[model samples]
Target: MYKKMIKNAAGVILSLSLAIASCGMTVNAQESKDKPSVTSNSLNAGGRVSKNQSGATATTTFSRPGNIRAKAIVYYRLGEDDYHSEDVKTNNAGGTTAFAEKKVSNANVVGAKGEHRVVYGDIIWNDETHIGLTLPNSKLK
Candidate 1:
Protein backbone atom coordinates (compact mmCIF):
# COMPACT_ATOMS: atom_id res chain seq x y z
CA MET A 1 0.00 0.00 0.00
CA TYR A 2 2.85 2.43 0.75
CA LYS A 3 4.50 1.84 -2.66
CA LYS A 4 1.22 2.31 -4.45
CA MET A 5 0.59 5.60 -2.68
CA ILE A 6 4.06 6.91 -3.65
CA LYS A 7 3.48 6.10 -7.34
CA ASN A 8 0.13 7.83 -7.37
CA ALA A 9 1.53 10.95 -5.70
CA ALA A 10 4.31 11.18 -8.27
CA GLY A 11 1.79 10.94 -11.11
CA VAL A 12 -0.30 13.73 -9.60
CA ILE A 13 2.75 15.98 -9.26
CA LEU A 14 3.75 15.43 -12.85
CA SER A 15 0.27 16.18 -14.11
CA LEU A 16 0.07 19.40 -12.12
CA SER A 17 3.41 20.58 -13.47
CA LEU A 18 2.30 19.99 -17.04
CA ALA A 19 -0.94 21.85 -16.43
CA ILE A 20 0.85 24.87 -15.04
CA ALA A 21 3.31 25.02 -17.91
CA SER A 22 0.55 24.81 -20.50
CA CYS A 23 -1.40 27.57 -18.81
CA GLY A 24 1.60 29.89 -18.93
CA MET A 25 2.06 29.22 -22.64
CA THR A 26 -1.59 29.92 -23.36
CA VAL A 27 -1.37 33.29 -21.60
CA ASN A 28 1.68 34.25 -23.64
CA ALA A 29 -0.03 33.32 -26.88
CA GLN A 30 -3.02 35.45 -26.00
CA GLU A 31 -0.81 38.41 -25.20
CA SER A 32 0.92 38.20 -28.57
CA LYS A 33 -2.40 38.11 -30.39
CA ASP A 34 -3.56 41.28 -28.62
CA LYS A 35 -0.36 43.23 -29.23
CA PRO A 36 -0.74 46.36 -31.34
CA SER A 37 0.91 46.75 -34.77
CA VAL A 38 2.67 50.04 -35.51
CA THR A 39 6.02 51.43 -36.73
CA SER A 40 7.44 54.87 -37.54
CA ASN A 41 10.47 56.83 -38.65
CA SER A 42 12.27 59.26 -36.39
CA LEU A 43 11.08 62.86 -36.69
CA ASN A 44 12.79 64.54 -39.64
CA ALA A 45 13.53 68.29 -39.69
CA GLY A 46 13.78 69.48 -43.24
CA GLY A 47 15.59 72.09 -45.36
CA ARG A 48 18.28 74.71 -44.73
CA VAL A 49 17.86 77.34 -42.01
CA SER A 50 14.37 78.90 -42.43
CA LYS A 51 13.02 75.88 -44.32
CA ASN A 52 10.55 73.35 -42.91
CA GLN A 53 11.36 69.68 -42.74
CA SER A 54 8.83 67.80 -44.88
CA GLY A 55 7.56 65.31 -42.23
CA ALA A 56 8.11 61.90 -40.70
CA THR A 57 6.73 58.60 -41.97
CA ALA A 58 4.55 56.14 -40.06
CA THR A 59 3.90 52.53 -41.05
CA THR A 60 1.41 50.10 -39.57
CA THR A 61 0.40 46.48 -40.09
CA PHE A 62 -2.85 45.30 -38.53
CA SER A 63 -4.08 41.74 -38.29
CA ARG A 64 -7.21 43.15 -39.92
CA PRO A 65 -7.60 46.21 -42.09
CA GLY A 66 -9.14 49.09 -40.15
CA ASN A 67 -8.67 52.78 -39.63
CA ILE A 68 -5.97 53.49 -37.06
CA ARG A 69 -4.52 56.66 -35.62
CA ALA A 70 -1.40 57.59 -33.72
CA LYS A 71 -0.28 60.73 -31.96
CA ALA A 72 3.16 62.26 -31.53
CA ILE A 73 4.45 65.25 -29.63
CA VAL A 74 6.73 67.07 -32.02
CA TYR A 75 9.39 69.39 -30.60
CA TYR A 76 10.73 71.72 -33.22
CA ARG A 77 12.72 74.93 -33.63
CA LEU A 78 11.99 76.98 -36.70
CA GLY A 79 14.64 79.37 -38.01
CA GLU A 80 15.42 81.71 -35.10
CA ASP A 81 12.35 80.97 -33.00
CA ASP A 82 12.50 79.31 -29.58
CA TYR A 83 11.93 75.54 -29.58
CA HIS A 84 8.33 74.49 -28.91
CA SER A 85 6.20 71.36 -28.87
CA GLU A 86 2.94 70.38 -30.52
CA ASP A 87 0.77 67.27 -30.49
CA VAL A 88 0.14 65.96 -33.98
CA LYS A 89 -2.23 63.24 -35.07
CA THR A 90 -1.46 60.84 -37.90
CA ASN A 91 -3.85 58.30 -39.38
CA ASN A 92 -3.92 55.24 -41.58
CA ALA A 93 -6.90 54.21 -43.72
CA GLY A 94 -6.53 50.43 -43.77
CA GLY A 95 -9.29 50.32 -46.40
CA THR A 96 -10.01 46.58 -46.26
CA THR A 97 -6.28 45.78 -46.20
CA ALA A 98 -3.99 44.55 -43.46
CA PHE A 99 -1.31 47.18 -44.13
CA ALA A 100 -1.36 50.97 -44.27
CA GLU A 101 1.19 53.76 -43.89
CA LYS A 102 1.46 57.53 -44.21
CA LYS A 103 4.05 60.28 -44.30
CA VAL A 104 2.81 63.30 -42.31
CA SER A 105 4.24 66.72 -43.06
CA ASN A 106 3.69 70.19 -41.58
CA ALA A 107 5.26 72.58 -44.06
CA ASN A 108 4.82 75.69 -41.94
CA VAL A 109 8.19 77.38 -41.59
CA VAL A 110 7.68 80.49 -39.43
CA GLY A 111 11.25 81.68 -39.16
CA ALA A 112 14.63 81.70 -40.94
CA LYS A 113 17.22 81.69 -38.15
CA GLY A 114 19.32 79.22 -40.18
CA GLU A 115 19.06 76.62 -37.36
CA HIS A 116 16.36 74.12 -36.42
CA ARG A 117 15.88 71.04 -34.25
CA VAL A 118 13.22 68.32 -34.30
CA VAL A 119 12.62 65.80 -31.53
CA TYR A 120 9.78 63.42 -30.78
CA GLY A 121 8.58 63.68 -27.19
CA ASP A 122 6.19 60.73 -27.11
CA ILE A 123 4.21 58.55 -29.48
CA ILE A 124 1.14 56.43 -28.88
CA TRP A 125 -1.20 54.24 -30.90
CA ASN A 126 -4.98 53.91 -30.78
CA ASP A 127 -6.17 50.66 -29.25
CA GLU A 128 -9.60 51.46 -30.68
CA THR A 129 -10.53 55.16 -30.83
CA HIS A 130 -8.59 56.37 -27.78
CA ILE A 131 -4.86 56.24 -27.11
CA GLY A 132 -3.45 52.89 -26.15
CA LEU A 133 0.13 52.03 -25.25
CA THR A 134 3.00 54.46 -25.56
CA LEU A 135 5.80 53.27 -27.84
CA PRO A 136 9.46 53.43 -26.96
CA ASN A 137 11.38 56.40 -28.29
CA SER A 138 13.97 55.71 -30.96
CA LYS A 139 17.41 57.28 -31.27
CA LEU A 140 17.14 60.67 -32.91
CA LYS A 141 19.35 61.77 -35.80
Candidate 2:
Protein backbone atom coordinates (compact mmCIF):
# COMPACT_ATOMS: atom_id res chain seq x y z
CA MET A 1 0.00 0.00 0.00
CA TYR A 2 2.84 2.42 0.85
CA LYS A 3 4.55 1.83 -2.52
CA LYS A 4 1.29 2.29 -4.44
CA MET A 5 0.54 5.61 -2.68
CA ILE A 6 4.02 6.90 -3.42
CA LYS A 7 3.65 6.09 -7.15
CA ASN A 8 0.29 7.85 -7.34
CA ALA A 9 1.68 10.99 -5.69
CA ALA A 10 4.65 11.05 -8.11
CA GLY A 11 2.32 10.75 -11.11
CA VAL A 12 0.20 13.68 -9.88
CA ILE A 13 3.28 15.90 -9.40
CA LEU A 14 4.56 15.05 -12.88
CA SER A 15 1.23 15.92 -14.48
CA LEU A 16 1.03 19.29 -12.72
CA SER A 17 4.58 20.15 -13.72
CA LEU A 18 3.87 19.44 -17.37
CA ALA A 19 0.68 21.55 -17.29
CA ILE A 20 2.48 24.53 -15.73
CA ALA A 21 5.35 24.41 -18.18
CA SER A 22 3.02 24.29 -21.18
CA CYS A 23 1.09 27.30 -19.92
CA GLY A 24 4.31 29.33 -19.60
CA MET A 25 5.39 28.43 -23.11
CA THR A 26 2.04 29.50 -24.50
CA VAL A 27 2.21 32.87 -22.75
CA ASN A 28 5.73 33.54 -24.05
CA ALA A 29 4.72 32.77 -27.61
CA GLN A 30 1.80 35.19 -27.41
CA GLU A 31 4.03 37.94 -26.02
CA SER A 32 6.50 37.55 -28.84
CA LYS A 33 3.75 38.34 -31.34
CA ASP A 34 2.80 41.65 -29.66
CA LYS A 35 2.29 44.76 -31.73
CA PRO A 36 5.40 46.70 -32.72
CA SER A 37 6.14 50.33 -31.70
CA VAL A 38 5.60 52.87 -34.46
CA THR A 39 6.89 56.44 -34.70
CA SER A 40 5.74 59.22 -37.06
CA ASN A 41 8.61 61.41 -38.22
CA SER A 42 6.89 63.89 -40.49
CA LEU A 43 4.03 64.47 -42.92
CA ASN A 44 3.88 67.36 -45.32
CA ALA A 45 2.42 68.58 -48.61
CA GLY A 46 4.32 71.37 -50.36
CA GLY A 47 5.73 72.73 -53.62
CA ARG A 48 2.61 74.44 -54.85
CA VAL A 49 2.75 75.86 -58.38
CA SER A 50 2.22 79.61 -58.42
CA LYS A 51 0.94 80.01 -61.99
CA ASN A 52 -1.61 77.17 -62.19
CA GLN A 53 -2.00 77.00 -58.37
CA SER A 54 -2.85 73.36 -58.87
CA GLY A 55 0.18 71.25 -57.94
CA ALA A 56 1.78 70.13 -54.66
CA THR A 57 3.81 67.34 -53.04
CA ALA A 58 2.85 64.97 -50.23
CA THR A 59 5.43 63.40 -47.92
CA THR A 60 4.98 60.81 -45.16
CA THR A 61 7.86 59.73 -42.97
CA PHE A 62 7.72 56.98 -40.35
CA SER A 63 9.78 54.40 -38.47
CA ARG A 64 9.56 51.48 -36.07
CA PRO A 65 11.22 51.39 -32.66
CA GLY A 66 12.88 48.00 -32.99
CA ASN A 67 15.49 46.11 -34.99
CA ILE A 68 12.98 43.73 -36.53
CA ARG A 69 11.79 44.22 -40.11
CA ALA A 70 8.20 45.29 -40.86
CA LYS A 71 5.87 46.65 -43.54
CA ALA A 72 4.37 50.15 -43.79
CA ILE A 73 1.70 51.87 -45.84
CA VAL A 74 1.49 55.64 -46.15
CA TYR A 75 -1.92 57.03 -47.06
CA TYR A 76 -2.62 60.48 -48.40
CA ARG A 77 -5.88 62.28 -48.76
CA LEU A 78 -5.98 65.45 -50.81
CA GLY A 79 -8.93 67.72 -50.25
CA GLU A 80 -12.04 65.76 -49.31
CA ASP A 81 -12.27 62.98 -51.88
CA ASP A 82 -8.89 62.54 -53.55
CA TYR A 83 -6.92 59.68 -52.03
CA HIS A 84 -3.47 58.21 -52.78
CA SER A 85 -1.04 55.83 -51.13
CA GLU A 86 2.46 54.31 -51.15
CA ASP A 87 3.87 51.10 -49.69
CA VAL A 88 7.28 50.79 -48.04
CA LYS A 89 9.32 47.83 -46.86
CA THR A 90 11.31 48.82 -43.78
CA ASN A 91 15.01 47.93 -43.53
CA ASN A 92 15.88 45.02 -41.29
CA ALA A 93 17.94 47.29 -39.06
CA GLY A 94 14.84 49.48 -38.54
CA GLY A 95 15.01 53.16 -39.64
CA THR A 96 12.90 55.97 -41.01
CA THR A 97 11.54 55.70 -44.55
CA ALA A 98 9.93 58.49 -46.52
CA PHE A 99 7.11 58.36 -49.06
CA ALA A 100 6.49 61.41 -51.19
CA GLU A 101 4.61 62.28 -54.35
CA LYS A 102 3.98 65.40 -56.43
CA LYS A 103 1.45 63.89 -58.83
CA VAL A 104 -1.60 65.77 -57.65
CA SER A 105 -2.87 67.94 -60.49
CA ASN A 106 -5.73 70.38 -60.96
CA ALA A 107 -8.21 67.59 -61.62
CA ASN A 108 -7.52 65.94 -58.24
CA VAL A 109 -8.45 69.03 -56.24
CA VAL A 110 -11.81 69.14 -54.50
CA GLY A 111 -12.21 72.88 -54.91
CA ALA A 112 -9.93 75.80 -55.73
CA LYS A 113 -7.53 74.45 -53.06
CA GLY A 114 -7.75 72.00 -50.17
CA GLU A 115 -5.87 70.62 -47.22
CA HIS A 116 -4.11 67.24 -47.31
CA ARG A 117 -3.89 64.71 -44.50
CA VAL A 118 -1.06 62.19 -44.37
CA VAL A 119 -1.50 58.97 -42.44
CA TYR A 120 0.84 55.99 -42.05
CA GLY A 121 0.99 52.66 -40.25
CA ASP A 122 3.45 49.86 -39.45
CA ILE A 123 2.28 46.26 -39.05
CA ILE A 124 4.29 43.95 -36.87
CA TRP A 125 4.93 40.52 -38.38
CA ASN A 126 1.74 41.04 -40.35
CA ASP A 127 -0.33 40.80 -37.21
CA GLU A 128 -3.87 42.18 -36.84
CA THR A 129 -2.81 45.17 -34.72
CA HIS A 130 -1.75 48.11 -36.94
CA ILE A 131 0.12 51.02 -35.31
CA GLY A 132 -0.23 54.37 -37.11
CA LEU A 133 -0.82 58.10 -36.98
CA THR A 134 -2.44 60.94 -38.91
CA LEU A 135 -0.37 64.09 -38.99
CA PRO A 136 -1.72 67.63 -39.15
CA ASN A 137 -3.25 68.67 -42.44
CA SER A 138 -1.50 71.01 -44.87
CA LYS A 139 -2.56 72.88 -47.98
CA LEU A 140 -2.87 70.51 -50.94
CA LYS A 141 -2.39 73.36 -53.37
Best by TM-score: 2
Residue 93 shift from truth in candidate 2, angstroms: 1.2
In angstroms, what RMSD does candidate 1 have relative to the true structure? 16.7
TM-score of each: 0.22, 0.24
lDDT of 2 at 83: 40
What residue pairs clash in candidate 2, if any at all?
Answer: none
lDDT of 1 by residue, 88-133 (tens): 3323333111111112233221211111122223432222111122
Tell me the spans in candidate 1 whose CA falls farther than 4 Å from its real position. Answer: 1-52, 72-74, 83-141
Worst 10 residues of 2 by lDDT: 44-53
Listed per model in order, the count of residue pairs whose N, CA or C atoms clash below 3 Å is 3, 0
